[model samples]
Target: MVTYRAYIKKDYKAEIRWEPDHPFLAGLARISFMTVLLVIPWLLLGMKAPELTPTSSPVSKSVITSQQDRIIEPSAIDNGLVIDTAYLPENEIFETTGLEPPELEEIIDPINDQVTEAAWQSVVVSKGDNLARIFSRLNLSARDLDAIMALGEDTLVLKHLQPEQVIQFQIDDNQFKSLKYPASLVTTLHVVKTDDGFRAETLTEELEIRIKHVNVIIDDSLFLSGVEAGLSDNLIMQLVAIYGWDIDFALDIRSGDHFSMIYEERYKNGNKVSEGPVLAAEFVNQNIPYRAVRYTYEDGQSDYYSETGRSMRKAFLRTPVNFTRISSGFSLKRKHPILNKVRAHRGVDYAALSGTPVKATGDGIVTYLGRNGGLGKAVILKHGGQYSTVYAHLSNYKQGLRSGNRVKQGQIIGYVGMTGLASGPHLHYEFRVNGVHRNPLKVELPQATGIPEEEMKHFTTQIEPLLAELDNITAKSGLITVNSHSDLRSSVL
Candidate 1:
C-alpha cells in the first residue's frame, strides 16, 4: 500500500536481540546474517538453471557413440554465424571414452554362431575313384558309403563317379548333414540325413528342347561342312542315316549338293547340354531331293518319313559296310586279280581295313556260312522270293551264325579280310534278283512300311510346316535346287 517512490527506497530487515554484557555474541550475530545473504542468491540460481535448460532423455552407451560419430561441425553460410556443437554433460562423458560398445557383442555374437552352425564341403571325383575310396579319403566311415548305396538303383547312379564329377556335402560337427551329386546336366541325386536313417531323392531338372535349323553346301566332305555349319558329328551321322537308303553317300554325292535340317538341342539352366534328335531334314543329291520328317507314333515307336508319310527306310542299305572306296564294281566280264585270267566279276569289292565289321545288307536267312573255293570265307543269304546276297573274303563270321540262321539287316555278319582272290583287305558283295545278277549300287530297293492310313492326316499336318521351313531356308540362301514343298509332299502322299 506504500507509494511507488517510497517502496523503491525502502530497506527490508529482520530484527534480532543480543545481550549488552556479551560483545562476542553481537559479533557472531553480524557474521551469521552476512553469510546467509551471500548463500541465498547462489542457491536460487542453481534451482532456476535446471528449468531454463532443455532436458534430454537418458541415452545408452551405444546410442551416445552413434550420435557423436554421426554429428558434423556446422559450416558458415555466406560468412554468417556458424553454430558450434555444445559439450556433453559430465554423466555422458564416459560414453565417448573410446571403449567398445556393448551392443556389438549383442549383434556379432549371433552372426558368428550362424557361420559355425552350417558349413559345406565339395570334392571332385579323381581318376580311379570309387565311393569307398572317396569316402575314405575324406575320413568318412565305410558305413556311410554302404548306407548311401543301399538306397536302391536310383541311388546307384551316384556310385559310378566319373572323373571331374563333383560331390558336395553339408557338414555339421564332422558328420554329413546332406550330400548332393550332379549325375547329369538334368539330374541330381540328393541324400539327406533324417531321423529315420537316410533318405535319397533324385531331382530331375527340367530341360528346354529348342528346335534349330542349319543349311550346308557340300564343297569338300560332309563332315567338314557339318562342322562349319555348327553341327555336331553325332547330328551329321544322324543326317546321313536318314537319307542313306535313297542316296549312296560315297558314290552318288556330287558337287553343288546341299542339305538342310531342323534338329533338337537340349538345354538346362540356359546352357546347351547335348543334341537331341533330328526333327526334319532334306538332302539334294545329283539334282534329286530327298526329304524326311521324324514322327513318333502313339505307341512311342518313332521313324523318319517323307512329308507325304512314306517311310524313309528301304529293304536294304545302299552300302553293306562302311568302306573307304569302291575297289571293284559289278561287271559281266573282268579279269580277276589273283586268277590272272578274264572272268565274270559279278560283285563290288569294298576296300577297308582288315577286321572292319561287315553288316548284312538285307534281312535274310543264311544259305551258306563256310569257306568257299575262290571267295575265301563266304556267307550266302537268301531273301524272300527274288533277292539273294553274297558276302565274301571275310575275317570271320559272327559267332553262333550258321547256314539256315536268320539275320537282320545291319547285323554284323562277318569282318573284312584278304581271303580268296582278293589282293588286299576288302569286302566282296554281290546282289542277285532271281537267278540273274544285278548291280548292287543301282538296284531299286523296296520301300519300308509307311505311316498307317489313319495316321497320315496327322503326319502330313506335322511335316508340312517342317517341309515349308526347309524350302524357305534353301530358297532364301540359294543353297540348292530342291523340290518345292508341295511337290515333295505330293510325291510322298
Candidate 2:
C-alpha cells in the first residue's frame, strides 16, 4: 500500500496518506458481490415452491377394491353422494376429469314424409282465349308450349275448345308439371320423367256408346233432314256408305224419299263426344222401301245386308258417275237433239263441267276405247260373263287408258265432254247384258258375296249388342218416316 502526507497551516501541520493498489482489490470485491447477488434469490424462491395435492379421496381406493371383491355395501356414501360400490368401486375411481360422455345425436324426419301438398293454380279460358296466348302470359317457355302442343294433331284442334273451359296447372317450384281441363267433359294429362325424356299420358273417362232416339220429319235434303233430326255428322257418313252402291247420292235422291236409321251415340263423362256407325237404315224412294242391316262375318269382314241376309252391295254400282248432275233419263222413241229424229235413248246422260272425271262402273277389262259413229270418244268395259258397260261422250281418256287394260270399279277412266253427237258437255252411261240394252236404274242387280260362314257366329255375337243399341236410339228418336213425299221438297235431290 502507498501513503501520502501533507501539512495544512504552519501552526498545525497535518499528514495525508493515499493507497495506490486499491483498484485491483475493488475489482475482486465487485465480482464477489455479483456472485452472491445472483445465487441468493434463486435459493430462496426454490425453497418456497408450491406442491401438487392428491385428487382422489383416501377412501376411493378402499371402495374400488371392495367393489371388485364384491364385498361393498350399497349404503356407502362420500361428499353427501351415495356411491354405487357394488357396480362401480372407488379403487376404479371414475376419472371423468378430462373425459365426457358421448353426445346423444338428435333425430331428424325425412322431407318427403313431412311435406304438404302444393296448391294448384287454375284458369278458366274466357271467350277468345287460346292455350298459346295464355301460356305466354304466364311466362312459360316456348319449348314447353311446343312439347304440350306436340301431343297429337287430332287433340290439338282448338275449334272444339269452348269458352269457360276450366284449365288447371300444377306448378311445382315455379315449373309446369301437370295440366287438366274440364268442360262439359273432363280430360287430365300427367307429365312423367322417363329415361328417354319427359312424356305426357292422357287420362280420360271411359266412353259409353249410348242409344237415344228422336224422330224428325223429312222437310228437305237428306243431309239437312238428318241434321234437323239431330243426327250427328258421323252417322250421316255411315248412312251414305251403307247405301252408296244402290243410291247415287249425286242424282237419284228425290225430295220425297224418307229415311230411318238406328245408330250408336258415344258419350264420355256423361257428355256426347260423337255418334258411331249405323246399325240399320231404311230408305223409301218412289214408294219402294229399302232396308239395310250391318252384319259382320267371322272372317272380320263387315257389310250391309238385307233382312233376308242378302248383301246390300251390288256386283256393279248403278252408275260410273262422280260428282255430277243427271241431265236426262233413258227414254224410248225420243228425238235426239243432234240427230233430230225419233231415236231410242237407251242410256242416261249425266251433266258435269268439262274435264270432270268419270269412273268405271265395275271391275272389268277394257274391250274398246275409241271413236265410233255418233258416240264420239267412248270406252267399253267388259265385265265377267254376260255383263258389259259403255261410257260415251268423253273429252279425253285417263293416262295409259287403252284397250286390254284392266280397270277396277270406281277407277277413273276418262273425263266428261260432248265428244259424240251430243248437245252439251255430259256423260252417256249404258248397261248391257249379253248385248241386250236395259235400264241402268231399273235392272235387278246381283248382290256381293256375304261374309264367310265360319265367322258368322262370332260376328253375330259381337255386332248384336251394337245393333240393339243403334235400334234403340232410332226407335226413340221417332224421326222414322215412310212413303210420304208431299211435305219433302225437291231441293233434296
Candidate 3:
C-alpha cells in the first residue's frame, strides 16, 4: 500500500510512502500457514475417480447378462490375451447406454485412409543397351524374353531402344506383372504377362494445349529480343514465318520494333512438352502496326488474316533466301562487276553462304532448271497467269526437284551459289510479269484469298477474343516475358 505526503515550502513537493502493515486490511494472504488446514475435508471424506472415453477403436464384447450385470471382475482381466483395438469382434455391446455410440469413422479413419501404391522398378537405357542386356541385368528369365519377342510386329519397337528412353515394370514375389516403355511424347508401349503369353499394346496420351503470351521490344535484333522474352528457337522461327511475307527480317527490322502474340504450348501431366502455332499476333515495325489472327474455314484449311479480314499473306514472298546483304539491285545501264562493261542489270543479287537454302517465292511449275549462257544453272517458276520468277547462280538444286515439277510457296527449291558470271556466293533473282522484267524488291505482289463475305461475321466472332486476350495481357503487363496461364482449357479432355 502507498500513501502520498505533502511538504509546505517555497517549492512544494509530493512524496510517496509505503504502508506494509495496513490497518484497514486484516487476515489477508496466509497461504503457507493455511496449507495443512485445507486437507481436513479430504480426511473426513474420500477419494474418487471419473471414467474416461476410449481414444482407440472399441472392441465389441459378447454378454449373456444385462448391461449393469455384465461388468467384468478383476479376475476376468487376463494378461495373456492380446487386445487388438484396430477391429471389433462381431458381437453386441456389453453395456447398453441410452446415448448413441460413435461410428468408426467419427473419431478414427474418418476418410477411410486406405491406399495401395504400385512398386515399380524403372531403368534408363544407355548407349549400347538392348532388351536382352537390360533383361539380363534385371535377372529376368530368357524364356519370358523369348515370349515377348514372339508377340509379333507390335513388339518390334522394343528391339530398338534408344538412349534416354525409360522402361518401367512391376514385380512382386520375383514375378513380373507388367512393363511399359515410353516411345514418344504421345505414345507408350505397354506389355503385360497374360495367362497364355505376353500382350503388347500402344497407349496414347491425350495432350493438353495451353495458351502462352509473350511481348518483346526489340533492342538490337528480333532474335535477341525473343531470347529476352524467353522464346525458343522454334517459336522465333514460327514468328518470322508468320510475318515473313509482309516484312523482310533480313533488312526491314528496326531497333525499336515491338511485337506481342499468344501461342500454344502442349502439356502432359501438368508439365510443358512442346510449343504450337501462333494464334494471334501484333507486330509494330517502324511505327507501323500490323496485326494477324489465325482463321480456319469449314474445309479444314487455316490461314492468317488481319483484324479486318484481310489475308496477312500475299501471293509471293518478298525475300527468298536468308541472305546477308544485297549485292546488286535491279537497274538498267549499270557497269558490270566482272566484265567492267555497261550492261542492263535486270535482277537483284543476294550475297549469302554457299549452301544457304533458296526458297520458292510462290507456288508455280518449274519451267527451266538448267544452264544458260551467263546465267549458269537456274530454275524458273511459271506461276498461274502472267507471272514468272527466275533463280540464277545455283550451286545445286534441292533433291527430288526436277523440271516440270510443281513447287509450293516458301519451299526450298535450290541453294545459293556462284556458278556463272559471278564473283562470289550469291543468288541472282529476277521477277517478270508477262514478258516485261520487274524489280523483285519494289514490285507490288498480288494479294492472296481472304475470308469470304459471308464468313466475315463468323471469323470476327471467333478470333476477336484471342486478340482481346493478347491485348489485355499486354495492357496489364508491359513488354516482358510472361506466362499468363489464363485457362482457355485449350484441348484438355
* Per-model TM-score versus the true fold: 0.70, 0.54, 0.66
Rank order (by TM-score, best first): 1, 3, 2
RMSD of each: 37.9, 47.5, 28.0
Q: Evaluated with TM-score, which candidate comes out highest?
A: 1
Residue pairs that clash (backbone atoms under 3 angstroms), model 3: none
Q: lDDT by residue for model 1 over 1-493, one digit each (tens)?
A: 1011111111001001112233643454465467667854543343233222332322332344333332321232244432212246534444444344354455342212222234456677899898788778777777877887898976889767998666877666667667778888788887876656777778788899999988888886675677668776568768877776666554567877888888999875344568959988878776677778899887888899887787888777666776767777777777777777778878888887899888888899999998898899999999899999999999899888999999998888999997886788999999999968889877777777788999988887877787788777777777646454432322443
Q: For candidate 2, give the lDDT.
A: 0.60
User: Where does candidate 2 stray beyond 4 Å?
Assistant: 1-176, 179-189, 193-197, 202-205, 213-229, 233-237, 240-260, 282-289, 322-336, 339-345, 369-374, 399-408, 451-493
Query: How would the candidate models be sorted by lDDT, starting from the highest?
Result: 1, 3, 2
Task: Write candidate 2's Cα lDDT for 233-327 as tens digits.
Answer: 45665677777656655456677676666667886433355676676766665545566777765466667875445566667777676434566
Give Cα-based local distance difference scores for all models.
Answer: 0.70, 0.60, 0.69
Give the Å error, residue 440, model 1: 1.5
The better-scoring model by TM-score among 1 and 2 is 1
Q: What's the lDDT for residue 29 in model 1? A: 49
